[model samples]
Target: MTECLDAIYQRRSVRKFTSDPVDRQIVEKLIQDAQMAPSAGNLQARDFIVVTNTAVKKKLKEAALDQKFLVQAPVIIVFCANTPRSSRIYSGRGELYSIQDASISAMVMTLAAHDMGLATCWVGAFNDADISEILMIPHNIRPVCMLALGYPADTPDTPDRIDASKLIHWQSW
Candidate 1:
């Protein structure tokens, strides 16, 4: 299998991580990869906040339902959707697609981190109001997702997948 495909298959939501620190350059590269994710009509309305400080991570941990992994990871990426930025591009359509675009970007970031030998766990289980307040994000910016990244301390075996035949059909059902 191609390395890219291999990476895709091997990528897992790693929860435990080593104490190793990921350099800023690697984090930047992952964000660059995320920016390449496809968006509706090419209207990239996503904004990302990279948090590397321990104190900030601690606050985010609380905001993230006290997930210790949030602070344990070397870096945490906060993905937000800017309604104004998206709305200006596609008007009504942009507003509808902004959250979707942000989600796609977050997925890309996680995959890129995995490919770079770093592990990541996508954190959507949190209180939005607390997150917004802790992150100091304006109300105009909506938090969509957060990613915790670090060197993996463990990688679980790939989870089972549903049968493709059962999921796909040649034509309309």
Candidate 2:
């Protein structure tokens, strides 16, 4: 399989991480690569908050349904969407597209980290108000997801996939 395909197949949502700290430089590079993702008309409405501070991580952990793994991981990246920027392009449909854009960016960042010998977990279950307060996200931006990153304590095998036959169709649904 091609390297990119291999990475996609191998990437898993790692919930356990070692105490080792991920390099700041590498994290920056991954974030940069994530921005290369296609956005709605290249508006690049997605914004990221990189949390490396312990206190902030702790607060985020509380906001994130008491997910201690978030605090244990060396890095936590919060992906947010700038609705106003996206709204300018697509009008009524901008909100949906902007959400899609942000989610794709977060997924890419997680896969990139896996390819770089790191582990990450994408988190979406949380209170928006608490998250915004904890992360200081602006009202105009909507939080899409948060990623917890570090070296893996354990890597689980790939989860089962649905039968392709059940998902694929010829021309119409």
Candidate 3:
């Protein structure tokens, strides 16, 4: 439990990454770990698109508002939400649930990568339509976020946090 907490605390949003390539096996492991994250009604309405090709990475960089890290990192995994899968059981709320499922999965994947001595940075600021077109994603699945993954070239200092007491609400705010 301590180790898990340690990993959680130490994990940072690494922007500068070494050029070292991440192995396919390790990426697969990270995905597997992400799948362990809980989903709404166990729908698991999420899929990951791994990008290693330089050309695709460059295009992704463009789609992500020209974040150079997208191309610098050895791997970029685009987490997506499958609305159809969630809506099949959840009806009107399924699309929202699918987005939640993908978000949680991305969080878990970042933590898992930290545990494996790898680094990850979540890229949320992107044009959804551009991402979909660049990745050739279908209509049913929407790209939630992209994770830039690799060995860290820079370890940023942890910024100060707000007091937990102030943020935590009791029975009511």
Candidate 4:
């Protein structure tokens, strides 16, 4: 398989991490890859906050349903969406679209990190209000998700996936 496809297949959510830190330049490049993801109407409403502080990571871990791995990871990226930027044109649909934009960007970042031999877990269980208060997120920006990134302390086997034939439909379901 080609390198990109190989990376896609190999990508997995890693939960345990060592204390080693990732290079700042690599993290920035991953963020840049995320920015390249397509956005609705090209509004590009996604914003990211890279968190490395111990206290903040601890608070974030609490916000994220006490997921201990969140604190263990060397970096946590909080992905937020600027609702007004898309809502101006798409109205009610914009709110949802902006969320989609942020999610797409997060996925791109995850894939890029995996390609670089780093590990990540997409975390979505956080209390939005709590995270907003802890991170000081702006009222206009909604926190969509968080990604915990670092080098893995353990490698996990890929979980079983449903057969493609069971999921695919021809022209109609």
**Least accurate stretch of 10 residues (summed lDDT) in model 1?**
87-96
Count: clashes, candidate 2: 0
Model 2 C-alpha lDDT per residue in residues 72-163, reported as the tens digit of each score: 99999999988888999898678887887888899889788888899889999888999998877888789989999999998798889999
- Candidate 4, superposed: residue stretches over 4 Å from native: none
User: Model 3 over residues 31-106: C-alpha lDDT tens digits?
Assistant: 9999999999999999999999999999999988899999999999999999999999999899999999999999
Q: Write out the backbone clash pairs for model 4.
A: none
Model 4 residue 10 distance off true place after TM-score fit, in angstroms: 0.3
lDDT over C-alpha atoms for residue 39 of model 4? 98
The clash count for each model shown is 0, 0, 0, 0
lDDT of 1 by residue, 35-122 (tens): 9998877878889999999999999999888999998899999999877788886787776688988999998887788887899999
Alpha carbon lDDT of residue 95, candidate 3? 94
**Deviation (Å) of 124 in candidate 1:** 0.8
Model 3, residue 114: what's the lDDT? 92
Error of 3 at 63 (Å): 1.1
Ranking by lDDT: 3, 4, 1, 2
Reference-based lDDT, each prediction: 0.89, 0.89, 0.95, 0.94
For TM-score, candidate 1 versus 4, the one ahead is: 4
- Which stretches in model 1 have alpha-carbon errors above 4 Å? none
lDDT of 3 at 170: 92
